[model samples]
Target: MRRDDPIPLVVDLDGTLLRSDLLLESALAYTRAQPLRLLAPLAWLAGGKAHLKQRLAQAAEIDVTTLPYDQRVLDLIGRERAAGRRIVLATASHQLYAERIAAHLQLFDEVLATENGVNLSAERKRDRLLQQYGQRGYDYAGNSNDDLPVWAAARHAYVVSAGGRLQRRAAALGNVAAVMAPVAPLQQLRTMLRAMRVHQWVKNVLIFLPLLAAHAANQPTRVLAGVLAFICFSLCASSVYLLNDLLDLPDDRRHKSKRKRPFAAGQLSLGIGMALAPLLLLAAFGLALWLLPWRFSAVLLAYYAITLGYSLYLKRLMALDAITLAALYTLRLIAGAAAFAVPLTFWLLAFSMFIFLSLALVKRYAELREARRRGETAQASGRGYFPGDLEMISSLGAASGYLSVLVLALYTQDRATVALYSRPQLIWLACPLLLFWVTRTWMLTHRGQMHDDPVVFALKDRASLLVGLLFALIFWGAS
Candidate 1:
């Protein structure tokens, strides 16, 4: 095409130029920052879609630099602009976000976006483009069903990150200029699974500790109840994980590995995640009320409430966050006891709190170590600790771990231990093993080889696994 004959290349914002939706992004940010004002969005929606967008735009601020942009689309836009094409950013997203994105890229010659009471989308977008470029006089780049009407009216279609069916449909419209391949189904599935954090269900297995400790593991009825409780806690835990990710978006984006998370990376829409989290939580409580005893359900509710509180506010408090995390882990044990109507003794609870607190501190130490490795000297993002506090964290964590071993040793002298184990002295071997494992974990953290999640590290490490196996054998022989 000649320089004088270049058609304006109009690009859609959400899912076209960007991999995420601004409306959902803004809404989620608003909900997270002002949870009590949640109904404000619905009230705005009652006015109109444009009004809703305007209100949310005023309330929420997105870090444009962190937004995931389709690299291929950026390259295409760059090439078109270099060839003197007049690039137009025409998005249904409110003008507030659209203008910011346009300003960031500096590629859009003109920006046409929703403002005032009219949501500029679909046929509305098509009409506006026609008014400026005339019918079939402009090229449009878009990536969803909402863009089909605009594509039909455009001179050419540029499909960005659209599935095969969408590309075929766009082709049938007779103006397929180009198609950017979508992410593979298997890859998307993997991302979604990671987002849901199925692997973290390992933590919920702590719900069986009370049954095992009380020697009720062999009872079929108690075992069944414990397993059901485990499921409920797993679901509830997943919901909290999702919420944490949503709230930690900015900090996660700044982190090395967390930036790849579904919500933070823009692989999953914030709207879908916001909707799915509540459903998972509801399903968890439903199982609790239907199958578990009232006490168990109450414990589960308390666990959820405490965890939700941790995610919202407590997580920022340095030592308090670690202590709260330990309590959360101990609550799983309490939940199990409640579920199976088993007695949770003071010794077991004390041992668990100390051990889990150590692990929680290990998680923080690893985070600070990573920050230091990356040359970060200020306070860690979304955390109260600084890199300079790593030494103290290590000291406290190691001390906490040893205290748990001491608790275990003290438990051996209890009358209950003597009654439960014919050869209670064999349990002494487990303490040394526990000590070695804890020492090794702290050493790994010091060496910067530890994962930010100590439990995940334990699960993945061969040495930790062997130590755990030895403990199981020692306990089994004593029993």
Candidate 2:
């Protein structure tokens, strides 16, 4: 080590001083946070490390409260800090979270982590380290060859684990100290699968199908009630999603895609997610009451019953599994109407089936497309589709498009709808336009741009916006 007083100690965040990467843990924390990117590892196999890193980084997210860290490791850091060494916890992890860990540990004299939107990696860490403490001489600890550039640049190095690939890389470097810890076991497979976000049941908010269909029909109170009902359902649904993610943390780790989730990746602990779940449920139920004080709690109960069943066994059955989900979605629309004490027309129910069936098919298509693209067999695991069925998906999508339009035509022609509209004839124009819009929406999905969540997509897509605005204008004008 170079001669200098008050040495600076640098530490890596993931697989170093800390137990696991918090970013991965949180990103995979949701039951539906998994959208795509299972194919990125295939890219890795094709020697697209940089591309894989880029894709994985997009998937990276962290909820600090949920992150896991051994108390013993924290104590080690605390004692080191008491010794008056200038301790720095540095890593390629996002700076916001790295700083959070540093603050929680409260032992680091300085955090040499990524900050100002820069990651501490290779030359980046080296440059900052050299510029900041080169004249002072410092000790740095890390765990990968990726850490080599900075380790070689440091005055002294603590090479933790000198036997793995990282150890071989450290062999050529002088000033290396040998200290290796036993590897922590991988997260449980079942827990990891839950983390993969296969069942994002809460986004079923679009189930306000009946109310939206009769939006302009002089049923403002009823429409508002139904909308509020769906929103209530959404909050409750999200609470369930959080709980499922917590429960499935163990299973999620077995799959390549699921291992990156918060619990499975060892970033977030099961306890925190579990603790957070009930609080969310409380808030959700409270919101439900505020939205629909007229006894909408029953809907929440039903949702829970059906979803818990789906999570336990329905999800594992091939064709019936996804169909169960479709039924659940349709049920939400029905429940919304029932919550508002509004009766639905046959057309309204049929429209719900058409739209949801299309969405279900599209979801399957996206997942299968992702599987094929990634060379993963997961889509075929308890799934009914194969790569050769893309054309069938398009056909099914077209049928749904036509059926959705037909449902709307029947709805508009109905006496209730005709009475609701101020200019009922102008409303007919909306049918073909809506049909085109629906087809276009699915086309975008087919092109791989369908954001995983359709409701969010409707809110985000410009075309969906225009179509919606036109519908609103005609409906309001007619009323």
Candidate 1 C-alpha lDDT tens digits along 289-386: 99999998898899889988888778998799999999999999999999999889999999999999999999999888888888889999878999
Find the candidate with the highest TM-score and give its number: 1
For all candidates in order, the CA lDDT equals: 0.89, 0.64
Candidate 2 RMSD computed on C-alpha atoms after optimal superposition onto the true structure: 15.7
lDDT of 2 by residue, 1-479 (tens): 22234677787777677556444443443223443444545654365433433444445444444344545455545655666667787777655666777776566766665545455678887888888778436777776677888888777777653336667667677767645553443533344334434355445555555565556335777767766676667656766666655545544544445546665555554555656567666776777766675446766777777776666546656556556667777778667766666566787668777876777777767666766677664435434567666678768866876788888777777787777666777878889888888888778878887645665577677888899899888766777
Error of 1 at 420 (Å): 1.6
Off by over 4 Å in 1: 1-4, 163-168
What's model 1's lDDT at 71? 86
